[model samples]
Target: MAPSWVNDRSYYQEDCPIYFATDFRQIRNSLSHADYRRINGGNRITLSEFYKQYHKYIMLLYQNGRELWSIQNIEKIDLGDVTEFNRMIFE
Candidate 1:
């Protein structure tokens, strides 16, 4: 099956966070802890570990609606595993 988080073009305009809910919370930053929690509600990712390699011009966003935080990248790092993505953001 296709990647669950790989929503098609239509998903782009979704204002609700549930569309990306499963994945976004996995990478949420502590700087946005409260806002993330508020936006995410108690509907957090309860699934087993899964990861994606996100190489963006920015950290873009990992929140629900309006972005709670933003990170610009002058450098890009690709972690082949989701666990690495976790470490890169949290550590």
Candidate 2:
């Protein structure tokens, strides 16, 4: 069956992967704080990489409308407005 995170719409390409991530657990796991930064954090996405895979970049926010994580096609982005766009999505 398709992943529960994915709905019946093509929000992503054909079958983009879904991720359920957390910050507290990462801290407990001794992961670097950089990776755990909020979705609005700086360098959330790479310009060069995004341009290279411009056809596969999509982001989804979840969980109390707090988290912002990338989904499939996560390399392409014509829109450079991460904060504005994300705010719109989560707001």
Instruction: Using TM-score, give the best candidate's number.
Output: 1
Q: Best lDDT goes to which candidate?
A: 1
Q: How accurate locally is residue 35 in candidate 1, as Cα lDDT from 0 to 100?
A: 49
Per-prediction TM-score, please?
0.20, 0.17
| Candidate 1 C-alpha RMSD relative to the actual structure | 13.5
| Cα-based lDDT for every prediction | 0.40, 0.40
Model 2: per-residue Cα lDDT over 1-91, one tens digit each:
5465455346454543332123223332433444543333343433343333432333333332443343334345445677557545645
- List ranges where model 2 is wrong by over 4 Å: 1-8, 11-13, 17-46, 51-58, 62-91
Checking candidate 1 for backbone clashes, the offending pairs are none
